[model samples]
Target: MNKGKGRELRAMLRDWRAAAGVYASLQWRCFHQDGRFDPFLDPATQYRKDGAKVRAGIIRQIVLKHELDVPVPEPVKEGEKPKKRVLPTPPGLSDCLAPMKAALGAAQVQMVQGQVIGTLKSFISNRQNDFVDIVLGSTIDDLGRRQLFTINRATAWFDLGRSVKVETVEIPLSARLLARKIMSHILARHKKPSMKRIGMVVDKRVAELEESRSATSHDLWLKVTVKSGDHRSRRIAIPMRSNDYFSSRQGERKKTFQIIEDRETGRITVGVVTDVGSSFEERRMAYASRAQGPKALDFGLVTMFASDDGDLMGREFLRKLKSIDTTISGIARHVQRSGGKPRDSKRYVAHVTRLRGFITTELRRILNRFVAVRKPTTIFLERLNFQSPELSRRMNRILQNCGRGVLRAKLQALNEEFGVESHEVVSAYTSQTCSCCGYVDRRNRKAQAVFACRWCGRSLHADVNAARNIGSERFRSIGSARRVVRSNVLDMLVTQHVQRNTGERGAPADPRMSNPHFAAWADKARLSTKAA
Candidate 1:
């Protein structure tokens, strides 16, 4: 009900925000987007090209303001300029002011220009809702409103000769742009609390993760149960399969081994791991088939363990034996902050000691504890260039940015700390470079891991060699993802030597092995020794 002129309206908004305890500020860009504007690359460009005119204009404005006792608007420069990079245009000024701005726009357009206007008036500490009120209550008439030019959102007020009727101005979403611009500035400069998505180079090939960015909609809920003596009643979901390894019975079982030849290649084939798990399940299904007719044979994932009344504490014992982990992460901010640093104790302190502990501790508890028999001495792993573009495209950007870098970094770092040398180096040519006969032909390396080398009659396992090569390549380009000369993990000759030493234990003693003349002599010597 108390609004006045155009300038008075702007002043009202400013005074309202201040009076209402709002801390919002204004940013203004003096020149709007126009095609025929001088492109300025650096601050020196503005100084070099429009040094005289711009300086003269500033001086003229200052002198005119001095003569007329008014304040002058600040010049537009970058770097030294503040975070806010917006310039406000008064109503109806965009059409008329386009011509005036065009003249100065010739003075080299600084793309990121901004002016900040605070809430307080020149002569009055009290917030005034309109220009009329400020002018009426001030010692200086025009000077009170002239100060509005300090803010980028109010730059048009000064540029249009400081008349103060900026009502109906198109408020650019400059604050949003300013927020993003400031974040970029911080990241580029590597300032405190910076987040940079730079290349995760391991040798020349950068690491990237191509994964399901979204967590899988968990299906197949695991339902645990126990059967002792025969009293089983409740129904539950099928239990999840776990990798179990236990010792077999000592007595010889009905098992046979024989060599077979490939039908096409006439090549000899080796035996495969006995499907004991499948056989055990089959026996169970056979018993069920007798009890429940035809449908009982459809065992699916169901199981019934033979037990005795002596082992009667059934469900409780099984539940105790079966270990499970409760992972807590990626929750809402409120929960994250509320969780706090795991209550400060030896157990809690160890986990809170940074990501190394988190990764290594969890890796052992989750992965290592389950493996049976001989603990893997040389752990075979596919060295995922988690920083690769292929992986980046496949995986979510957040994981592409953090998961690989953090995981790989933590793994290597933990290896040293825990005295565990369990890591591999991946050759850039894992996919292109053939593992068989050391051939580097990209054409033959089709698909993911199936490789048929043209040079040799050797077929290579893509993922296998890639995994082996990952272990193999580690000799040269170890302890560095941040810097590598090129993607080549190592030259071919070095790779061959490393592979031979690792694969065949330095040199071959058996005659049927590799060395030819030695093989002939050794074969003859063996025959002679047998005769003697």
Candidate 2:
């Protein structure tokens, strides 16, 4: 009795309720014709006119977003964008916006980048439990409509835990007008459209022209174009000191070019610089794969048939209904060992599509920021190899986790067409060897990230040393892992085996595969203790 009384007292004193992370696709119409600025949604068109159904959906999103502790998105202003300005929007909404951009970037993001976009499943935790979310926008629902909450429906699904499937529902509505409508209404609440609005808006105009720059050879200044077609380009400059590391000369037609080299070791390492005219197979593959949608699964009917009056009329009446019906349905993923994979992903199709959308969009953003070339520069990376007897299962799993194969595939295609990646080989002790003291000791690496040399007391990031060795170091002529530059027993066999199989002589895939220098690098760094 006392415990129950205490609980009742606690419930009566709570202040805030749950939070909402509402997500709605944003669309901006260039009201100015010159693409100078995008206006918020037109209230007269969205709320005060024919798009009544669309307005209600937007309102419901608003209520749910608030419930998730996420503040409502402000309207898009005349000159400002939501993503750049919303640097400080509440955390939940910001996170939700990320996957949405990945999943759907004005439909234009999907067409340009041939990859999967992830879903936008926002999380809304309870800040306080005092009250439940009220869905009618700024106004209470009518008595009949209010009952919709008591019986489980759309509103209740938001409360499901992390794994529940909540995706972008294509309601046969226009995201453009819907976005504008939502933005307009939010702006109205502020009396004036503030600068901090539409933090999630992806201007379609900006989306379309961004890929055009990929056509340039990465040897000049990288431009960050904002408000495209309106002639606004914000270029970020990367200075390549034109020395041995970055040098250039005229070709047959006086075409100036530059070679990029290592900063410390003075070795030439190439960077991403694709030819504008080259048709990269990577892009082709991306376009091809984009045609193949997510692997699907199908499920049988799960719910009892409902009557016209909302009454359940079937054998499952005695059982409690699932709070969420058909939210995350799929065929093969959910199928048991005894049950074969489903032929189609009829149930959770929306979720898969949304998730893929998110991934592809994020990838596009990464590409936009890092994939650049002005001077034919180079970067040295240790060769990645998983097909080896030395690799443990967990180590293999970690390599897979890095998605090296996929990443390589992407870069390979890009480089082949553009000639951007000009990787070279130093073939030295990449691991178990110290770049500074020519020490090699497998035990020198006490941790995955840390490497300490016993002979010289020089420590380095294990991976960094490995990358540097593949660029500048040379053959030590020893066939061991105990020196700064030595070859491994595995390396010896691999070079020969590779030659025999492919008739092409190359060390292991790692640039340091059979480099002569690191023969004793590992022995020099070998842990006096036994190999762990």
Q: Which of the numbered candidates is closest to the native, going by highest lDDT?
A: 2
**Model 2 residue 309 CA deviation in Å:** 69
What is the Cα-based lDDT of residue 47 in candidate 2? 31
Candidate 1 lDDT over 1-532, as tens digits, reads 1122223323322322232221111111222221111222233333344555555565645555456554434544566533232323223322222332232221111111110122112111221122233233335434323333222234232233232233545323343233234323423444221112111111101111122234354222222121112333222222122222212422222222112333223233222124344455554454334431100000000111111111111123122212111111222223447765433233432322333333234434322331221223333333333232322231223233444555455445334322223443333554444444554445656664366754454675444444343444433344332223233443543345334533222232421233331343345556776788
Each candidate's clash count: 30, 85
**lDDT per residue as tens, model 2, 467-527:** 4444433322332222222234336433433343432223433222234433443243334
TM-score of each: 0.25, 0.25
RMSD of 2: 30.6
User: Which stretches of candidate 1 lie above 4 Å from their native place?
Assistant: 1-191, 194-374, 377-395, 405-418, 422-426, 473-482, 487-532
